[model samples]
Target: MSELLQFVFSGITVGAVYALVALGFTIIFNASGVVNFAQGEFVMLGGMITVFAHAAGLPLPLAALIAIVVTAAVGVALNRLAIEPARGAPVVSLIIITIGASIFIRGASQLIFDKQIHSFPAFSGDDPIHVLGATILMQSLWVIGGALAVFAGLWLFFTKTLLGRAVLATSNNRMAAQLVGINTKFVMTLSFALSAAIGAFGGVLVTPITLTAYDVGLALALKGFAAAMLGGMGNPKGALVGGLLLGLLEALTAGYLSSQYKDAAAFVIILAVLFFMPQGLFGRKSTDRV
Candidate 1:
Protein backbone atom coordinates (compact mmCIF):
# COMPACT_ATOMS: atom_id res chain seq x y z
CA MET A 1 0.00 0.00 0.00
CA SER A 2 2.82 2.38 0.86
CA GLU A 3 4.52 1.52 -2.39
CA LEU A 4 1.32 2.18 -4.27
CA LEU A 5 0.87 5.47 -2.48
CA GLN A 6 4.41 6.47 -3.38
CA PHE A 7 3.77 5.79 -7.03
CA VAL A 8 0.53 7.76 -6.96
CA PHE A 9 2.19 10.74 -5.34
CA SER A 10 4.98 10.79 -7.88
CA GLY A 11 2.54 10.26 -10.71
CA ILE A 12 0.35 13.15 -9.67
CA THR A 13 3.31 15.52 -9.56
CA VAL A 14 4.47 14.61 -13.05
CA GLY A 15 0.88 14.48 -14.25
CA ALA A 16 0.30 18.04 -13.12
CA VAL A 17 3.13 19.20 -15.31
CA TYR A 18 1.80 17.20 -18.24
CA ALA A 19 -1.64 18.69 -17.65
CA LEU A 20 -0.26 22.21 -17.96
CA VAL A 21 1.48 21.36 -21.23
CA ALA A 22 -1.69 19.74 -22.54
CA LEU A 23 -3.64 22.87 -21.68
CA GLY A 24 -1.19 24.87 -23.77
CA PHE A 25 -1.81 22.58 -26.73
CA THR A 26 -5.58 22.84 -26.37
CA ILE A 27 -5.51 26.64 -26.20
CA ILE A 28 -3.49 27.03 -29.38
CA PHE A 29 -5.47 24.39 -31.27
CA ASN A 30 -8.81 25.89 -30.26
CA ALA A 31 -7.80 29.35 -31.37
CA SER A 32 -5.83 28.64 -34.53
CA GLY A 33 -7.04 25.21 -35.64
CA VAL A 34 -3.38 24.31 -35.84
CA VAL A 35 -1.37 22.14 -33.51
CA ASN A 36 1.66 24.08 -32.39
CA PHE A 37 4.30 21.38 -32.12
CA ALA A 38 6.47 24.14 -30.72
CA GLN A 39 4.48 24.09 -27.50
CA GLY A 40 7.28 22.29 -25.67
CA GLU A 41 9.80 24.87 -26.76
CA PHE A 42 8.00 27.37 -24.60
CA VAL A 43 8.56 25.12 -21.62
CA MET A 44 12.21 24.77 -22.48
CA LEU A 45 12.55 28.52 -22.77
CA GLY A 46 10.96 29.05 -19.40
CA GLY A 47 13.45 26.86 -17.60
CA MET A 48 16.51 27.79 -19.66
CA ILE A 49 15.82 31.52 -19.49
CA THR A 50 15.22 31.46 -15.78
CA VAL A 51 18.43 29.53 -15.18
CA PHE A 52 20.51 32.05 -17.09
CA ALA A 53 18.77 35.06 -15.63
CA HIS A 54 19.14 33.80 -12.09
CA ALA A 55 22.77 32.96 -12.74
CA ALA A 56 23.32 36.55 -13.85
CA GLY A 57 22.27 37.81 -10.41
CA LEU A 58 18.52 38.17 -10.75
CA PRO A 59 16.18 36.92 -8.07
CA LEU A 60 14.60 33.56 -8.84
CA PRO A 61 11.03 34.83 -8.74
CA LEU A 62 11.89 37.79 -10.94
CA ALA A 63 13.71 35.54 -13.36
CA ALA A 64 10.71 33.24 -13.63
CA LEU A 65 8.42 36.17 -14.32
CA ILE A 66 10.71 37.44 -17.04
CA ALA A 67 10.92 33.97 -18.56
CA ILE A 68 7.14 33.67 -18.79
CA VAL A 69 6.79 37.15 -20.32
CA VAL A 70 9.59 36.62 -22.80
CA THR A 71 8.21 33.26 -23.86
CA ALA A 72 4.79 34.83 -24.36
CA ALA A 73 6.36 37.43 -26.62
CA VAL A 74 8.13 34.71 -28.57
CA GLY A 75 4.78 32.97 -29.03
CA VAL A 76 3.28 36.18 -30.41
CA ALA A 77 6.25 36.52 -32.71
CA LEU A 78 5.86 32.91 -33.88
CA ASN A 79 2.26 33.64 -34.86
CA ARG A 80 3.12 36.80 -36.77
CA LEU A 81 6.25 35.48 -38.40
CA ALA A 82 5.53 31.85 -39.18
CA ILE A 83 1.90 30.89 -38.69
CA GLU A 84 0.35 34.14 -39.92
CA PRO A 85 2.17 34.30 -43.24
CA ALA A 86 1.25 30.69 -43.90
CA ARG A 87 -2.31 30.90 -42.77
CA GLY A 88 -4.86 28.81 -44.68
CA ALA A 89 -2.14 26.44 -45.76
CA PRO A 90 -2.81 22.72 -45.58
CA VAL A 91 -2.74 21.06 -42.17
CA VAL A 92 0.40 19.19 -43.18
CA SER A 93 2.16 22.46 -43.88
CA LEU A 94 1.17 23.85 -40.53
CA ILE A 95 2.41 20.71 -38.81
CA ILE A 96 5.72 20.86 -40.61
CA ILE A 97 6.07 24.53 -39.82
CA THR A 98 5.54 24.01 -36.13
CA ILE A 99 7.86 21.00 -36.06
CA GLY A 100 10.49 23.06 -37.88
CA ALA A 101 10.02 25.91 -35.43
CA SER A 102 10.52 23.51 -32.55
CA ILE A 103 13.72 22.19 -34.05
CA PHE A 104 14.98 25.72 -34.59
CA ILE A 105 14.24 26.64 -31.01
CA ARG A 106 15.98 23.53 -29.72
CA GLY A 107 19.07 24.30 -31.77
CA ALA A 108 19.06 27.85 -30.52
CA SER A 109 18.74 26.67 -26.94
CA GLN A 110 21.69 24.32 -27.33
CA LEU A 111 23.81 27.19 -28.63
CA ILE A 112 22.70 29.73 -26.03
CA PHE A 113 22.41 27.51 -22.94
CA ASP A 114 24.76 24.71 -23.91
CA LYS A 115 23.94 21.01 -23.51
CA GLN A 116 24.41 20.77 -19.76
CA ILE A 117 21.45 19.97 -17.52
CA HIS A 118 20.62 22.64 -14.99
CA SER A 119 18.20 23.20 -12.12
CA PHE A 120 17.43 25.76 -9.42
CA PRO A 121 16.49 25.69 -5.76
CA ALA A 122 12.95 24.79 -4.97
CA PHE A 123 10.50 27.50 -3.88
CA SER A 124 10.52 25.86 -0.52
CA GLY A 125 13.26 23.92 1.23
CA ASP A 126 13.97 20.45 -0.06
CA ASP A 127 12.10 18.49 2.55
CA PRO A 128 9.85 15.49 2.29
CA ILE A 129 6.34 15.50 3.66
CA HIS A 130 4.81 12.21 4.55
CA VAL A 131 1.22 11.48 3.66
CA LEU A 132 -0.37 8.11 4.33
CA GLY A 133 3.09 6.59 4.80
CA ALA A 134 4.33 7.93 1.50
CA THR A 135 6.87 10.72 1.43
CA ILE A 136 6.60 13.49 -1.16
CA LEU A 137 8.94 16.35 -1.79
CA MET A 138 8.01 19.92 -1.01
CA GLN A 139 8.56 20.88 -4.63
CA SER A 140 5.89 18.37 -5.63
CA LEU A 141 3.33 20.30 -3.68
CA TRP A 142 4.36 23.49 -5.43
CA VAL A 143 3.93 21.89 -8.83
CA ILE A 144 0.51 20.47 -7.99
CA GLY A 145 -0.61 23.72 -6.42
CA GLY A 146 0.57 25.67 -9.43
CA ALA A 147 -1.32 23.39 -11.81
CA LEU A 148 -4.55 23.73 -9.84
CA ALA A 149 -4.15 27.48 -9.66
CA VAL A 150 -3.69 27.73 -13.41
CA PHE A 151 -6.73 25.52 -14.06
CA ALA A 152 -8.87 27.62 -11.74
CA GLY A 153 -7.67 30.86 -13.25
CA LEU A 154 -8.35 29.63 -16.75
CA TRP A 155 -11.82 28.44 -15.82
CA LEU A 156 -12.64 31.85 -14.40
CA PHE A 157 -11.18 33.66 -17.38
CA PHE A 158 -13.10 31.57 -19.88
CA THR A 159 -16.39 31.77 -18.01
CA LYS A 160 -16.37 35.30 -16.64
CA THR A 161 -14.43 37.55 -18.99
CA LEU A 162 -15.41 39.28 -22.24
CA LEU A 163 -12.03 38.67 -23.88
CA GLY A 164 -12.34 35.00 -23.08
CA ARG A 165 -15.74 34.90 -24.77
CA ALA A 166 -14.30 36.59 -27.82
CA VAL A 167 -11.61 33.93 -27.97
CA LEU A 168 -14.21 31.21 -27.67
CA ALA A 169 -16.34 32.81 -30.34
CA THR A 170 -13.38 33.03 -32.67
CA SER A 171 -12.58 29.39 -32.06
CA ASN A 172 -16.15 28.45 -32.86
CA ASN A 173 -16.02 30.17 -36.25
CA ARG A 174 -13.36 32.63 -37.31
CA MET A 175 -15.38 34.18 -40.11
CA ALA A 176 -18.46 34.59 -37.99
CA ALA A 177 -16.40 35.97 -35.12
CA GLN A 178 -14.87 38.60 -37.37
CA LEU A 179 -18.28 39.50 -38.77
CA VAL A 180 -19.49 39.94 -35.20
CA GLY A 181 -16.71 42.45 -34.48
CA ILE A 182 -14.21 40.11 -32.84
CA ASN A 183 -10.65 40.61 -34.05
CA THR A 184 -9.81 37.08 -35.06
CA LYS A 185 -6.21 38.00 -35.65
CA PHE A 186 -5.86 39.43 -32.18
CA VAL A 187 -7.57 36.39 -30.82
CA MET A 188 -5.03 34.18 -32.53
CA THR A 189 -2.15 36.20 -31.16
CA LEU A 190 -3.62 36.20 -27.68
CA SER A 191 -4.11 32.44 -27.81
CA PHE A 192 -0.50 31.86 -28.69
CA ALA A 193 0.68 34.22 -25.98
CA LEU A 194 -1.52 32.69 -23.33
CA SER A 195 -0.63 29.15 -24.34
CA ALA A 196 3.07 29.91 -24.32
CA ALA A 197 2.81 31.62 -20.96
CA ILE A 198 1.12 28.57 -19.48
CA GLY A 199 3.74 26.19 -20.87
CA ALA A 200 6.57 28.35 -19.61
CA PHE A 201 4.99 28.63 -16.20
CA GLY A 202 4.85 24.84 -15.96
CA GLY A 203 8.52 24.59 -16.81
CA VAL A 204 9.40 27.14 -14.17
CA LEU A 205 7.45 25.28 -11.54
CA VAL A 206 8.77 21.80 -12.35
CA THR A 207 12.41 22.54 -13.18
CA PRO A 208 13.47 22.32 -9.57
CA ILE A 209 12.12 18.80 -9.36
CA THR A 210 12.86 17.50 -12.87
CA LEU A 211 15.98 19.50 -13.63
CA THR A 212 16.20 20.66 -17.24
CA ALA A 213 18.35 20.73 -20.35
CA TYR A 214 18.21 22.13 -23.86
CA ASP A 215 16.84 18.90 -25.33
CA VAL A 216 14.16 18.13 -22.77
CA GLY A 217 11.41 19.90 -24.67
CA LEU A 218 10.76 17.20 -27.23
CA ALA A 219 9.93 14.49 -24.74
CA LEU A 220 7.79 16.84 -22.70
CA ALA A 221 6.01 18.00 -25.83
CA LEU A 222 5.37 14.44 -26.95
CA LYS A 223 3.96 13.38 -23.61
CA GLY A 224 1.80 16.46 -23.38
CA PHE A 225 0.62 15.99 -26.94
CA ALA A 226 -0.26 12.40 -26.17
CA ALA A 227 -2.13 13.52 -23.12
CA ALA A 228 -4.07 16.02 -25.20
CA MET A 229 -4.94 13.37 -27.75
CA LEU A 230 -6.00 10.92 -25.07
CA GLY A 231 -8.37 13.42 -23.51
CA GLY A 232 -9.65 14.84 -26.80
CA MET A 233 -7.49 17.40 -28.53
CA GLY A 234 -9.63 20.52 -28.25
CA ASN A 235 -11.12 19.89 -24.83
CA PRO A 236 -9.45 21.44 -21.82
CA LYS A 237 -11.12 19.01 -19.45
CA GLY A 238 -9.92 16.16 -21.61
CA ALA A 239 -6.37 17.43 -21.52
CA LEU A 240 -6.34 17.52 -17.74
CA VAL A 241 -7.84 14.05 -17.37
CA GLY A 242 -5.64 12.51 -20.01
CA GLY A 243 -2.51 13.97 -18.52
CA LEU A 244 -3.22 12.67 -15.03
CA LEU A 245 -4.23 9.25 -16.36
CA LEU A 246 -1.08 8.93 -18.43
CA GLY A 247 1.09 9.93 -15.52
CA LEU A 248 -0.55 7.44 -13.16
CA LEU A 249 -0.25 4.65 -15.65
CA GLU A 250 3.38 5.39 -16.23
CA ALA A 251 4.06 5.50 -12.55
CA LEU A 252 2.30 2.22 -11.90
CA THR A 253 4.07 0.58 -14.77
CA ALA A 254 7.42 1.72 -13.55
CA GLY A 255 6.69 0.66 -10.02
CA TYR A 256 5.32 -2.77 -10.77
CA LEU A 257 6.91 -3.62 -14.08
CA SER A 258 10.13 -1.99 -15.22
CA SER A 259 11.39 1.53 -14.88
CA GLN A 260 13.12 1.24 -18.25
CA TYR A 261 9.74 0.93 -19.97
CA LYS A 262 8.24 3.95 -18.29
CA ASP A 263 8.11 6.00 -21.44
CA ALA A 264 6.60 3.17 -23.42
CA ALA A 265 3.72 3.00 -20.98
CA ALA A 266 2.29 6.25 -22.27
CA PHE A 267 2.41 5.10 -25.88
CA VAL A 268 0.72 1.83 -24.99
CA ILE A 269 -2.07 3.68 -23.29
CA ILE A 270 -2.42 6.00 -26.26
CA LEU A 271 -2.65 3.08 -28.61
CA ALA A 272 -5.20 1.36 -26.45
CA VAL A 273 -7.30 4.51 -26.13
CA LEU A 274 -7.12 5.11 -29.87
CA PHE A 275 -8.17 1.56 -30.60
CA PHE A 276 -11.12 1.63 -28.25
CA MET A 277 -12.29 5.19 -28.71
CA PRO A 278 -10.75 7.23 -31.48
CA GLN A 279 -12.48 10.41 -30.38
CA GLY A 280 -10.80 10.25 -26.95
CA LEU A 281 -12.50 10.34 -23.56
CA PHE A 282 -14.05 13.79 -23.77
CA GLY A 283 -13.77 14.50 -27.48
CA ARG A 284 -17.00 14.98 -29.36
CA LYS A 285 -17.44 13.13 -32.63
CA SER A 286 -18.04 15.27 -35.70
CA THR A 287 -19.08 14.65 -39.27
CA ASP A 288 -17.70 16.53 -42.23
CA ARG A 289 -20.15 18.98 -43.82
CA VAL A 290 -20.53 17.93 -47.41
Candidate 2:
Protein backbone atom coordinates (compact mmCIF):
# COMPACT_ATOMS: atom_id res chain seq x y z
CA MET A 1 0.00 0.00 0.00
CA SER A 2 2.84 2.37 0.79
CA GLU A 3 4.46 1.55 -2.49
CA LEU A 4 1.21 2.24 -4.31
CA LEU A 5 0.82 5.52 -2.53
CA GLN A 6 4.37 6.49 -3.37
CA PHE A 7 3.76 5.83 -7.03
CA VAL A 8 0.54 7.81 -6.90
CA PHE A 9 2.34 10.78 -5.40
CA SER A 10 5.08 10.67 -7.99
CA GLY A 11 2.53 10.30 -10.79
CA ILE A 12 0.59 13.34 -9.63
CA THR A 13 3.73 15.45 -9.67
CA VAL A 14 4.63 14.40 -13.18
CA GLY A 15 1.03 14.62 -14.28
CA ALA A 16 0.81 18.21 -13.11
CA VAL A 17 3.65 19.05 -15.41
CA TYR A 18 1.95 17.21 -18.22
CA ALA A 19 -1.25 19.09 -17.52
CA LEU A 20 0.52 22.39 -17.92
CA VAL A 21 2.04 21.28 -21.20
CA ALA A 22 -1.32 19.98 -22.43
CA LEU A 23 -2.95 23.27 -21.57
CA GLY A 24 -0.34 25.00 -23.66
CA PHE A 25 -1.15 22.76 -26.60
CA THR A 26 -4.87 23.35 -26.25
CA ILE A 27 -4.44 27.11 -26.30
CA ILE A 28 -2.47 27.09 -29.51
CA PHE A 29 -4.65 24.51 -31.16
CA ASN A 30 -7.80 26.38 -30.37
CA ALA A 31 -6.51 29.74 -31.47
CA SER A 32 -4.58 28.73 -34.56
CA GLY A 33 -5.56 25.15 -35.35
CA VAL A 34 -1.91 24.29 -35.40
CA VAL A 35 -0.13 21.93 -33.05
CA ASN A 36 2.91 23.88 -31.98
CA PHE A 37 5.48 21.17 -31.49
CA ALA A 38 7.75 23.86 -30.11
CA GLN A 39 5.43 23.93 -27.09
CA GLY A 40 7.85 21.74 -25.18
CA GLU A 41 10.71 24.08 -25.95
CA PHE A 42 9.03 26.58 -23.67
CA VAL A 43 9.50 24.12 -20.83
CA MET A 44 13.08 23.46 -21.81
CA LEU A 45 13.82 27.16 -22.04
CA GLY A 46 12.23 27.73 -18.65
CA GLY A 47 14.41 25.20 -16.90
CA MET A 48 17.62 25.93 -18.79
CA ILE A 49 17.34 29.69 -18.44
CA THR A 50 16.42 29.50 -14.77
CA VAL A 51 19.43 27.29 -14.03
CA PHE A 52 21.87 29.55 -15.86
CA ALA A 53 20.35 32.70 -14.40
CA HIS A 54 20.43 31.33 -10.89
CA ALA A 55 24.00 30.18 -11.40
CA ALA A 56 24.82 33.71 -12.52
CA GLY A 57 23.66 34.92 -9.05
CA LEU A 58 20.05 35.87 -9.77
CA PRO A 59 17.49 34.92 -7.17
CA LEU A 60 15.39 31.92 -8.14
CA PRO A 61 12.16 33.88 -8.32
CA LEU A 62 13.71 36.57 -10.49
CA ALA A 63 15.33 33.97 -12.70
CA ALA A 64 12.04 32.21 -13.14
CA LEU A 65 10.36 35.48 -14.03
CA ILE A 66 12.93 36.13 -16.70
CA ALA A 67 12.58 32.64 -18.07
CA ILE A 68 8.82 32.83 -18.26
CA VAL A 69 8.84 36.24 -19.93
CA VAL A 70 11.52 35.28 -22.41
CA THR A 71 9.85 32.02 -23.28
CA ALA A 72 6.53 33.77 -23.77
CA ALA A 73 8.23 36.23 -26.09
CA VAL A 74 9.78 33.40 -28.03
CA GLY A 75 6.35 31.88 -28.41
CA VAL A 76 5.01 35.13 -29.80
CA ALA A 77 7.95 35.29 -32.15
CA LEU A 78 7.35 31.74 -33.30
CA ASN A 79 3.80 32.63 -34.24
CA ARG A 80 4.88 35.75 -36.10
CA LEU A 81 7.91 34.29 -37.84
CA ALA A 82 7.15 30.66 -38.59
CA ILE A 83 3.47 29.89 -38.15
CA GLU A 84 2.25 33.15 -39.60
CA PRO A 85 4.42 32.88 -42.68
CA ALA A 86 3.10 29.40 -43.27
CA ARG A 87 -0.51 30.39 -42.82
CA GLY A 88 -2.91 28.66 -45.25
CA ALA A 89 -0.28 26.01 -45.86
CA PRO A 90 -1.27 22.38 -45.96
CA VAL A 91 -1.66 20.59 -42.66
CA VAL A 92 1.42 18.56 -43.46
CA SER A 93 3.34 21.74 -44.16
CA LEU A 94 2.19 23.28 -40.91
CA ILE A 95 3.16 20.14 -39.04
CA ILE A 96 6.57 20.13 -40.63
CA ILE A 97 7.05 23.79 -39.85
CA THR A 98 6.23 23.34 -36.17
CA ILE A 99 8.37 20.21 -35.95
CA GLY A 100 11.19 22.07 -37.61
CA ALA A 101 10.76 24.88 -35.12
CA SER A 102 11.01 22.37 -32.28
CA ILE A 103 14.20 20.91 -33.70
CA PHE A 104 15.64 24.35 -34.20
CA ILE A 105 14.85 25.28 -30.62
CA ARG A 106 16.43 22.08 -29.30
CA GLY A 107 19.60 22.66 -31.29
CA ALA A 108 19.73 26.24 -30.09
CA SER A 109 19.23 25.17 -26.48
CA GLN A 110 22.10 22.72 -26.75
CA LEU A 111 24.33 25.44 -28.08
CA ILE A 112 23.28 28.07 -25.57
CA PHE A 113 22.87 26.00 -22.40
CA ASP A 114 25.20 23.04 -22.88
CA LYS A 115 23.98 19.45 -22.76
CA GLN A 116 24.36 18.98 -19.03
CA ILE A 117 21.35 18.06 -16.90
CA HIS A 118 20.75 20.93 -14.48
CA SER A 119 18.58 21.65 -11.46
CA PHE A 120 18.41 24.17 -8.66
CA PRO A 121 17.22 24.35 -5.09
CA ALA A 122 13.53 23.76 -4.57
CA PHE A 123 11.44 26.65 -3.27
CA SER A 124 10.85 24.74 -0.12
CA GLY A 125 13.63 22.68 1.36
CA ASP A 126 13.95 18.99 0.51
CA ASP A 127 11.83 17.86 3.39
CA PRO A 128 9.52 14.97 2.62
CA ILE A 129 6.00 15.09 3.98
CA HIS A 130 4.23 11.82 4.61
CA VAL A 131 0.55 11.28 3.93
CA LEU A 132 -1.30 8.00 3.92
CA GLY A 133 2.07 6.26 4.17
CA ALA A 134 3.41 8.04 1.10
CA THR A 135 6.29 10.49 1.31
CA ILE A 136 6.18 13.47 -1.08
CA LEU A 137 8.67 16.20 -1.65
CA MET A 138 7.65 19.73 -0.82
CA GLN A 139 8.56 20.58 -4.38
CA SER A 140 5.73 18.34 -5.57
CA LEU A 141 3.33 20.65 -3.81
CA TRP A 142 4.66 23.53 -5.90
CA VAL A 143 4.11 21.63 -9.13
CA ILE A 144 0.59 20.61 -8.17
CA GLY A 145 -0.25 24.03 -6.84
CA GLY A 146 1.15 25.73 -9.89
CA ALA A 147 -0.87 23.50 -12.18
CA LEU A 148 -4.09 24.11 -10.30
CA ALA A 149 -3.47 27.84 -10.19
CA VAL A 150 -2.79 28.06 -13.88
CA PHE A 151 -5.89 26.08 -14.68
CA ALA A 152 -8.02 28.25 -12.48
CA GLY A 153 -6.52 31.36 -13.92
CA LEU A 154 -7.13 30.15 -17.45
CA TRP A 155 -10.70 29.23 -16.58
CA LEU A 156 -11.32 32.71 -15.24
CA PHE A 157 -9.62 34.29 -18.21
CA PHE A 158 -11.73 32.44 -20.75
CA THR A 159 -14.97 32.79 -18.87
CA LYS A 160 -14.55 36.32 -17.62
CA THR A 161 -12.00 38.49 -19.44
CA LEU A 162 -12.91 40.37 -22.59
CA LEU A 163 -9.55 39.52 -24.16
CA GLY A 164 -10.08 35.90 -23.37
CA ARG A 165 -13.54 36.13 -24.86
CA ALA A 166 -11.93 37.53 -27.95
CA VAL A 167 -9.72 34.46 -28.04
CA LEU A 168 -12.73 32.22 -27.66
CA ALA A 169 -14.54 34.12 -30.36
CA THR A 170 -11.58 33.72 -32.65
CA SER A 171 -11.48 30.03 -31.93
CA ASN A 172 -15.16 29.58 -32.59
CA ASN A 173 -15.00 31.44 -35.90
CA ARG A 174 -12.08 33.49 -37.06
CA MET A 175 -14.02 35.20 -39.78
CA ALA A 176 -16.90 36.03 -37.48
CA ALA A 177 -14.56 37.40 -34.85
CA GLN A 178 -12.78 39.46 -37.46
CA LEU A 179 -16.13 40.72 -38.69
CA VAL A 180 -16.94 41.75 -35.16
CA GLY A 181 -13.72 43.84 -35.08
CA ILE A 182 -11.59 41.37 -33.16
CA ASN A 183 -7.96 41.32 -34.15
CA THR A 184 -7.51 37.64 -34.92
CA LYS A 185 -3.78 38.02 -35.36
CA PHE A 186 -3.46 39.50 -31.90
CA VAL A 187 -5.54 36.69 -30.51
CA MET A 188 -3.16 34.19 -32.06
CA THR A 189 -0.21 35.95 -30.54
CA LEU A 190 -1.86 36.10 -27.15
CA SER A 191 -2.65 32.40 -27.28
CA PHE A 192 0.94 31.57 -27.99
CA ALA A 193 2.17 33.80 -25.21
CA LEU A 194 -0.28 32.46 -22.66
CA SER A 195 0.50 28.88 -23.61
CA ALA A 196 4.22 29.38 -23.47
CA ALA A 197 3.99 31.18 -20.15
CA ILE A 198 2.10 28.25 -18.69
CA GLY A 199 4.62 25.77 -20.05
CA ALA A 200 7.53 27.81 -18.75
CA PHE A 201 5.92 28.13 -15.35
CA GLY A 202 5.63 24.35 -15.21
CA GLY A 203 9.26 24.05 -16.10
CA VAL A 204 10.21 26.43 -13.32
CA LEU A 205 8.16 24.55 -10.75
CA VAL A 206 9.24 21.04 -11.74
CA THR A 207 12.89 21.51 -12.72
CA PRO A 208 14.11 21.20 -9.15
CA ILE A 209 12.55 17.77 -8.93
CA THR A 210 12.85 16.61 -12.56
CA LEU A 211 16.20 18.14 -13.44
CA THR A 212 16.35 19.24 -17.07
CA ALA A 213 18.42 19.23 -20.22
CA TYR A 214 18.02 20.28 -23.83
CA ASP A 215 16.92 16.83 -24.98
CA VAL A 216 14.19 16.47 -22.36
CA GLY A 217 11.75 18.57 -24.39
CA LEU A 218 11.10 15.89 -27.00
CA ALA A 219 9.90 13.36 -24.49
CA LEU A 220 7.86 15.98 -22.70
CA ALA A 221 6.35 17.12 -25.98
CA LEU A 222 5.37 13.60 -26.86
CA LYS A 223 3.76 12.95 -23.50
CA GLY A 224 2.06 16.31 -23.38
CA PHE A 225 0.72 15.92 -26.91
CA ALA A 226 -0.58 12.51 -25.98
CA ALA A 227 -2.27 13.87 -22.91
CA ALA A 228 -3.90 16.63 -24.90
CA MET A 229 -5.16 14.12 -27.41
CA LEU A 230 -6.35 11.79 -24.69
CA GLY A 231 -8.46 14.47 -23.06
CA GLY A 232 -9.83 16.03 -26.25
CA MET A 233 -8.09 18.26 -28.65
CA GLY A 234 -8.63 21.93 -27.92
CA ASN A 235 -10.46 21.39 -24.64
CA PRO A 236 -8.97 22.84 -21.45
CA LYS A 237 -10.99 20.56 -19.20
CA GLY A 238 -9.95 17.58 -21.28
CA ALA A 239 -6.31 18.51 -20.95
CA LEU A 240 -6.55 18.53 -17.18
CA VAL A 241 -8.33 15.21 -16.94
CA GLY A 242 -6.14 13.59 -19.56
CA GLY A 243 -2.92 14.64 -17.88
CA LEU A 244 -4.03 13.39 -14.47
CA LEU A 245 -5.33 10.13 -15.90
CA LEU A 246 -2.16 9.51 -17.86
CA GLY A 247 -0.05 10.17 -14.79
CA LEU A 248 -2.16 7.97 -12.56
CA LEU A 249 -2.09 5.19 -15.14
CA GLU A 250 1.68 5.39 -15.28
CA ALA A 251 1.93 5.25 -11.50
CA LEU A 252 -0.29 2.22 -11.26
CA THR A 253 1.68 0.51 -13.96
CA ALA A 254 4.94 1.14 -12.18
CA GLY A 255 3.63 0.04 -8.83
CA TYR A 256 1.50 -2.99 -9.66
CA LEU A 257 2.96 -4.05 -12.94
CA SER A 258 6.29 -3.74 -14.69
CA SER A 259 8.37 -0.73 -13.90
CA GLN A 260 10.18 -1.19 -17.18
CA TYR A 261 6.98 -0.61 -19.17
CA LYS A 262 5.65 2.18 -17.03
CA ASP A 263 6.59 4.71 -19.65
CA ALA A 264 4.71 2.69 -22.21
CA ALA A 265 1.53 2.94 -20.21
CA ALA A 266 0.73 6.43 -21.44
CA PHE A 267 1.09 5.56 -25.10
CA VAL A 268 -0.75 2.29 -24.64
CA ILE A 269 -3.67 3.97 -22.98
CA ILE A 270 -3.64 6.65 -25.64
CA LEU A 271 -3.94 3.98 -28.30
CA ALA A 272 -6.69 2.23 -26.40
CA VAL A 273 -8.64 5.42 -25.95
CA LEU A 274 -8.20 6.34 -29.58
CA PHE A 275 -9.29 2.93 -30.64
CA PHE A 276 -12.59 3.16 -28.84
CA MET A 277 -13.57 6.78 -28.31
CA PRO A 278 -11.53 8.36 -31.11
CA GLN A 279 -12.61 11.86 -30.11
CA GLY A 280 -11.28 11.32 -26.55
CA LEU A 281 -12.77 11.48 -23.07
CA PHE A 282 -14.14 14.98 -23.27
CA GLY A 283 -13.82 15.65 -26.97
CA ARG A 284 -16.96 16.70 -28.80
CA LYS A 285 -18.18 14.56 -31.63
CA SER A 286 -17.78 16.20 -34.99
CA THR A 287 -19.27 15.47 -38.36
CA ASP A 288 -18.22 16.84 -41.68
CA ARG A 289 -20.66 19.37 -43.08
CA VAL A 290 -21.11 17.98 -46.51
TM agreement with the true structure for every prediction: 0.98, 0.98
As for candidate 2, its clashing pairs are none
lDDT of 2: 0.92
Residues 1-290 of candidate 1: C-alpha lDDT, one tens digit per residue: 99999999999999998999999999999999999899999999999999999999999999999999999999999999999999999999999999999999999999988999999999999989998899999999999899999999998999899999999999888999999999999999999999999999999999999999999999899899989989998999998998898889889999999999999987887788789988899999978878
Report per-prediction Cα RMSD to one decimal: 0.8, 0.9
Backbone clash numbers for all candidates listed? 0, 0
Clashing residue pairs in candidate 1 are none
* Model 2 misplaced stretches (Cα beyond 4 Å): none
Clashes of 2: 0
Kindly report the root-mean-square deviation of model 1 from the true structure over all alpha carbons: 0.8
Q: For candidate 2, lDDT tens digit of each residue in 29-92? A: 9999998888888999999999999999999999999999999999999999999998999999
